[model samples]
Target: MKQDQDNCDFIIQAGHDIYYTHKNVLSAGCDYFEAMLKYDTKESREGKVVFKDVDSECVKNCIDFIYSGEIEIPNEKMNDLLYAAIMMQLEDVKQAVSDILKRSITVENYFSTRKVADIYGLDAVSTRCRVFFSKNLMKISMQPGFGNIEKTDILNFVKSEKSGLYEEAKLTLSLRWVENNRKNEEHLHKCLEVIKFDKMSPAFLEHLLESNLIISNDFGLYKLFNGHLLKASKRLGKAKGEIDNRDFIILFDADTDCIRSLDPIAEKVEKFHDEKFKHLRDFGTISLDSYIYVPCENKSVHRLDCRSKNSKWEKMKDMICDHGEFPRSVSWSGLIFVIGGSCHKATNDVETFTYSLNQWSQLQNKPTAICDASLVSLDDSIYCIGGIGQDGVEVSSFCRFIPFSAEWVDLEPMRYPVSDMGVVAVDQKIFVLGGCSGGIEVNYVSCYDVISAQWTSLSSMIACRSFVSAHHMGNWIYAVAYGKVSNVIEKYDFSKDKWIIVKPEVDQCFTIYESTFVKL
Candidate 1:
């Protein structure tokens, strides 16, 4: 085919060069050439085709593929060849180019290839590149070529839900982009708009404001950040429970006097203050705002600010009543509520601690005297699930308490009477996980729809766990193990109706017994 250039009947012009090719061979492989040659098009009449925007080498590659069924493409020429194939409507050539591009995607060249795939609308190649990009965002962002990525790609990535980066990480990436490019206000605004400032920590927001990056360059961004900071301050407590803040579960290990923070996503564990809480057992733990409050049996409370790198347990005011012996606690409306448990015996005593007030107030006692009950707050009320009643027998009784009116209302009973069950509320549904039923552990998982006032059974967990701390973060319910199964953590997937165990990297078994799991 290369030697038959002298007898060629067609001429192809591309970017300062012309190629000789047979018209019959051109029409045989490419639909674009066949249609043009079969019709009264100017190209057919003139016996010539022109692709002014395409490079000569790309045109040569396409022509070579038309004659030989294949063409060798360099990593640097894949984009241009793909473009030429798209223009020539060569489906096979496009597929081949896309495959090469997919295989060529690397951390260093991701931005460049992603840009080409996105521009040419190559879904297969784009999807693969995006997956690679999401998985290696940190590494890709640090590359020297990161600053050269298109603004559109950056904005799309920043707005993507599957970017696999935390809000702060996204913010850092955006700032780095702006710093590298020295972008104008219009571009800077788009970058700032996608970042979830409301989700970032107050300390990070403060640091961002002090940094010369934003403060020195853009006034509009500074004002916008200030507004976000103000709103964040107003809703700081609630923000601490947001999805970004739920990256780690902080557990107060009473036996070892250590605070263990476990990152379920990262599967890593780190311990702090190994000897801090010596003999700190039988305490009700609740996290509000960014602080973890441990209410001791002696009515004294110790608060730890999780924001600090070296945060220590600071003493707070004593509780008004004795909230001792496996008392159930929940944080609602920025207040810590410790419900019924035994001080001397099973008592209906209830107390709520206001962090802002630093004072504990006794509330009306619960109607039923119970201990080891699962307490979860939903909407404007608190639900106290099954537990052992004062008669020393486990009951399936369910009740709701309205804090505003201070009234307790009895509700539908659970299918099985259970105690020490992991219970948590997400939206209008409450999930009651494995617990003890008649002195035996049950892997039963039940969900109660508050709106319908009905209980429905879901898939059972792989392992039975009692005294599990079930936490609702993102879309899954994490049941942190207790008793002999302390090393296991089961995650409930709502969509799949299944439970999967999560293993964290820890040097020792999680001694989660009598330990509190607070999503931080």
Candidate 2:
């Protein structure tokens, strides 16, 4: 039976609204109400309570939950309900509200929810938000509310192992945040302390010094970043933060089904991810984040997680059309583009795959039906370099592809006709290394400047062999001649136009035929 307002002994006033209830009903569920009603307080003698800090709707919901043991918790009123439950000492109601808030937390509402959790000292909610924040740091950092996050939370995220940010990225993000608040020099210093300055490369540190954000507004960081650059260049032995800071040249030999790791800085090669797989001939590989995608000639794609210790080749969605053998691939905007390869004969088939959706779709064919071409992504478009054209001849053909518009525009041809060459892009320039110019192997090297729209011939490699694989790391371009049994590895310094031999320093040599080399 419903009690009339006149018969109710307790009166609760929330803002302009009044809630009529009984002492027995209020005290049975709320400790705060029971203590007030039992004690000699003025509110107890008058049998009334006035709440100015809580919302009227939240107060009504809490009281309704007390009488009926159930209430609907709306998303918009979640924070108010939680605060009201806390004020009334409703343990069960508070727990239910907290669970609902945690369940509904997302990248968009994380900052607001975190503020509420911090206000109430909600450790569980705070911890869950931290975990969620770390996973989506890249995405959340771009949000408008990210700049308003507290300095302490930013530092904690910088220290998290799974933040998915490299040392350079972390430094840039911290500096960017500090740039927003120049008066907080103390906070900026604290943020700089947690970063592993030794892990940053000299080039990145120098680039940081050139940043107007640091040089113009914050001269103190300029000096600190400069000092770190000096220290980083002279630091002996391997750098710290091995998980996120280190870069390796991943060499996968499809013919022998063997994978090897080459530490570019140390010039050392080891079998770190040497797991053997079924023979994958003429497969193409591309590196994205921590995973490597291998599009096989068997029309299937496999992924390898570099972060996993027991990482095995995981099969992903198969291709919509048979990419066939010698398909060149590049990743842009989180999508994989597989260019022309050989089918019955040379085909200009093109396909794209989305890793998240686990689906593949066909794209417009290339202008020229080419196979064994070198594809590199830079700026916002992909460039397809030298390969064997439809006439079954080595070509100097060069073209630019815009994935956003699915448009292909022909650019200036290479300086020399080559196929199965080592090609890599760095600093808005593409370097083409040793490959076959005709039936005979050539050690010719060329550079194509995207900004200048011109080509320049550079110093040739020491080893004159075909089937070359190239990777760029830091300031060096490594070209591996895998056609011969020697497996000659040479690195080029574009600034000096010089090439030097790099020994593998491994116990066993790799049988590197039709291999893909990627920097991770």
Candidate 3:
């Protein structure tokens, strides 16, 4: 069949007799013809077959590849070759044509080629085009063909974890894309899923509240955003107990650098420092009454009693054993647990102090050296979220320590790695917030489910937030909004699954050494 092409016994015809080829030869290389010719049908018995609606030239090129494993794909006939190859299931020919087309992609043709790639299931080509679309996102999106991108493709691109567009730019362009195809406006919500709700400018969030596009469609997001924008400007609404006590909130008032007391019920902040303690930093606690602090200088323990008559910062006894580190501390069940910080070098040593005995004792060591990890105490356990791993790399690892067993068990990690994050526990589940480094960042929000042993991502923050400190009051969670564009109180309602920005009536902006929830 290969050597005697001119005297071939079988004849295959297609497209108005525009082309003809050998029967067995075409069947060997083409999946469609192989099964068709296996039977004693008229075409098989008579050694002839025909195909309509296929370009004669594309058919000939495919036949050439069958005989010699070589074919030239012209740019003009590229789509024709693609369609014919798919119809005949000529994988090798299809692959060769796809490779050539993929290499020839440009900003001018990315959208069109991507359409073809997707329709024909050319995944490799499709992947390449999507990446190209993401990298040159803004420039290519303004092109005419950008309007032709399918709604699913648009959703996938906006939420792409690899997308490098700035939050503001991404939202702006994406919203415009939505407006262009307003008939399919429901896809807008899906597009909104990947956007950083916290990263948007306060002014923009205000603007969104008034948009028919949002208010009429995104019911939950719209309602919560309206509440926040109103509160930021000192507008009080009838929504009571929605942002009330979780019992507590952590605050770092710009007017006072010391950690301040947050009054959730009255929506007020109170003085946190007395004469002897004008400054406090790097502290932790799980108990509502008093927090345990391991000072760095003398390495002494200090206590602030909310119920004490004097209510002054009192220095407790020095650590029983000098670990040579002032690690972050958290108190639970009248006991304080210390973990992570430099003890000459990064260490994972664990120690506990008893409130009754007032003595410190060593506990089981942690799995790895971690400093600057986000710590949250709940459910008789301490959750140690994202931190530096053994080799000093930012990690997405999550681990929990059971106080009774003095053992650390690893949990599923957050979707993104973060440092200087805020963790709040409400109802045995923990929510973790944002971190930024260098020039790139993620306004990521995710939660760990104790029951499911799974990590679920929540909506992103309003804007880029870093070094945020947060606490919970009932079902509502609040975090410090600290970025160049945002410095306010950001509230999140679990039921609403939306973020609200509240501006404190502070005289001026303030920074803090540390912030944590304390009952006063």
Candidate 4:
């Protein structure tokens, strides 16, 4: 066999044999049908002619079609070429013939082309052929057989100018089908499979409260799909022992500046929750004085002892580095880790004040300089959420600090960049709320799922707020004192997933900046 580079022609040489290629021996155009008889034995012609001889020009055309895998047949010869290509299993030639038929088919020839493509098992070509014949093709196209078109092919056709079938095709495909093709389809399905019931049954609402899916807004209501209203209700009527006992700790910024200023706001907190605290005296600024202190300013975290009367607040004998800024955001385990704050122009350095050693020590530095970011402890790790960086630039990305290893790992950035946001860890998930760095204040809430390493958008708060503080109690997360000198308080119910308004009894305006919460 001799192959032609530029044309679909092959020259075959057999010893003392001359025959022409054709589809069948008796085909009308195959004049070279007798050529095969000269080379074959008499017995070969006795049964049936599998091959036939055609006109010389037609033979050359077919040969060229076979070699090149493409042939531009005129409108009149299109049917003949298609039949020949299909018989010879010339896939490319068959496709080319289909393309021609698709572009030139009229009502008169539509059925014919459809029948030919269907017989040849060319589904794509058959669809195109059927579309040409039927005026209401979209209505019939969804009927079983057409559902198998490759998604990529459908998308491509929709993108093409010649194909005005996007709307029709889109109607046939459901959102579920589109979702099924996603790379994270299994994960999405798993999330949807878990049913959350509103009425209390065998499952506890606390389980839903623990879910990262529940969101609470500024209005103090937990929110689910379509803003399902959630209200605070004591666990009753079912398995009462399953309810867990957890206390609420309100964080207040009690730095020397806030305390010494003789602000009426500090007086109000002491008066309101006096019964809940064992000791209310200023514990001095633990963070700023030790880790985030400036050269001359006295910034410290006041330790408000909340334990029982017999239990005294143990001083983690930790000494501040000489001239080092006091720690702003501190987390306690074996030691206290303080993140970024203004020491000398807002240092991004991280330091640990070991409760055992009672001395502040330097740890790894953050990738970016930040201050006023919210820090929360979850799964024995400390996470620093949105804050303002150098030049007052707001950042949404977060970094985690591991106490055992003393390493910091970066996590996914938040959907919105904000500073002075309030964050609380509940059920191994991080709930971040109101904060602002630039002129824009954000009320949108977001939750970070630790296991999945993904973020989900939650309902927005009723009021835009900044510099908020959050406290988690039972299955509820409360956001208090957002914005400058505001007494706005909201509670989020994790069970029904809704926010409800709550009144915080406080007199005078105060900003809760870099505050810490301890469960009472």
Give per-residue CA lDDT, model 4, range 116-159, as digits (tens). Answer: 67776767777776465334333222223333334454444434
State the lDDT of candidate 3 residue by residue for 321-420, as single tens digits.
Answer: 3333335666543346767753223568777665433556666678788766767777547888876555656767788887645668987777766665
lDDT (C-alpha) at residue 333 in model 1: 45
Q: Where is model 1 poorest over a 10-residue stretch in terms of lDDT?
A: 238-247
List the global CA lDDT of all models: 0.74, 0.73, 0.63, 0.48
Candidate 2 per-residue lDDT, tens place, 1-520, comes to 1235877898899999888898887787778888999888999899888999899999888889989999878888888888898888888887887887788787668888899998987888888898887666544543446667688878886786666667756765565565445554467777778888887656456544643344545667677777887886565224443333367777665445667777878777676565675555557677764577878788888887765447778889888766577567876544578888743246688877655446576766787788777788775578888887778888889999865456799999987788777788887788888878876889988888888999998888887967677887788888876643245778888679898888767666566554444432
| Index of the highest-lDDT prediction | 1
Clashes of each: 0, 0, 12, 38
Off by over 4 Å in 1: 1-226, 229-246, 253-256, 272-275, 342-344, 483-486, 514-520
Candidate 4 deviant stretches above 4 angstroms:
1-246, 251-302, 308-327, 342-344, 482-486, 504-516
How does model 1 fare in lDDT? Answer: 0.74
Better of 1 and 3 by TM-score: 1
Output the worst ten-in-a-row residue range by lDDT, candidate 2.
Answer: 236-245
For candidate 4, which ten residues in a row score worst on lDDT?
288-297
TM-score between candidate 4 and the true structure? 0.42
